[model samples]
Target: MTHVMACIDNSQSSLAVCDYAAWASQRLNAPLTLLHVLDEEKYPAAADLSGNIGLGSREHLLEELATLDAQRARLALEQGQHMLEKARERTVISGAAFPELKQRHGHLVESLSDLQEDIRLLVIGRVGEDNSRNAHSLGSQIEAVVRTIHRPILITATSYKKPEKVMLAFDGSSTAYKTIQMFAASSLCKDLPIHLVTVGADSVSNHEALGKAQSMLLSAGFLVQAEIRQGEVESALHDYQTEHGIDLLVMGAYGHSRIRQFLVGSTTTTMLRTATMPVLLLR
Candidate 1:
């Protein structure tokens, strides 16, 4: 069966990730997979060790470093397993049915991408253990994972709250159209109160596009409210979200260039970074 993959690390947001994942799993009636990756780069306290030792005592120090790396890896492996166990228990308690646990050794993005086909939904936290709370940066691997995986990704906010209302930030791009279609076809957004807010200067095309999207969602049984407004994309969407107390934001990840849309200058990234609620990004 397809699974809702919850990617977690030893971060403040890990619990939130599991909670959201469990909710999705229950919603979709899919299995839950709590995945914790032990990437050396992500866990430098455990990564390979070769460069830092001095030349004169290189060989001996290299041996020591190797031993240390091995020990660190072992500890990390155990820790990751423990984390997965805890997360599994948490998910089960949160109404998930016996989530599968996975402990992996590799880069987070690559590993998840390889398993993307099996993932029906992806759940992750805004920040990770390695990232400082002070910065506005996303978890180091989040952007990369989002770009690589075509499945819907739910990026949790500071905490979890059952979304009372959902907003679709339509931009009238091809990606936006695709996102609306996917959302309409899926039961995930069906029956939910959804607001389709498009940001653009007054134009016939923009109005037509937003109206069409709204119609599609309505056909799928969504209680959709469509509106056209003018402003910068990110700020305008965020403002709408705030004004409406939107609990979830949906949008397309990439741009005109399907393959490179999310690489840069993507409004999806901006919204994901700053959204006060969860972001359900469609690729």
Candidate 2:
């Protein structure tokens, strides 16, 4: 079975993401592993600093430091447990099995890498409360994990409610086919109607690709429809989703090159900016 790892914090965005993860978990019949990492390196105990301590007070200061570290660790664990419990309650209500909560006292990047052995999908909130609004395209931790891991990542924003009307942006790429196969096999799309849109290099090419994708999805038991549009990928996709009231937008990330993603930018960047719904980005 596929295992989806949900990295959650106590932020408002995380709560909605947890609900969304639960929704996905039930549909995929996948095991949900709820993870929370305690970033003690960033938020260390203030009392542990020993710059002004004299020789006589060294022992007392060291003892106090130990006590403070213990307290901080305890509080972090307690907070993590509470958040996981709340997430579990939402998962049960969403008709999904409760996830196994995991709390690790370390950095998020390290924690995620350590548990990447059996994880199929990594789910995380778009941004946390501590994150700066100026930051673009996910937080530091999210970016680090995505860049490091090869697994598919579903980054959900706070505004995500539920994915009812879904849109698939197909480009006749291998990644696109992998994404489609995943959606077709998952329980998430069983009841969800999909709009298969293929952006055309030319009118004829676009029509052919869109028709092919529609036939494939129809054969897979999806209530699929096709739309062929001529324009820039980001603009065409954004406009189509907006007009159709799409709730979820699924597409392959970084089709051409990693260098292009950074230097020339990509359609994924443009779509992320213009999309009004949650994006399921496949590698």
Worst 10 residues of 1 by lDDT: 257-266
For candidate 2, the TM-score is 0.81
Candidate 1 versus the native: TM-score?
Answer: 0.89
lDDT of 1 at 170: 79
Task: Summarize candidate 2's per-residue lDDT along 104-213 as a digit string, tens digits.
Answer: 87788888888888677778876665663523444545556656667777778675577889888787666666767766766666878999987766577557666777
lDDT of 1 by residue, 1-283 (tens): 2888998788888888888888888878889998888986634554455566565767767777777877888899899899999998898899999988887788888888888889999998888778747336677667777768888888887678877788987778887789988888776665679999877778998889888898888878889899976766777777888798888888777655322333354333555666678888887
Q: Against the unseen true structure, what C-alpha lDDT does each candidate score? A: 0.79, 0.71
How much is the lDDT of residue 80 in candidate 1? 89
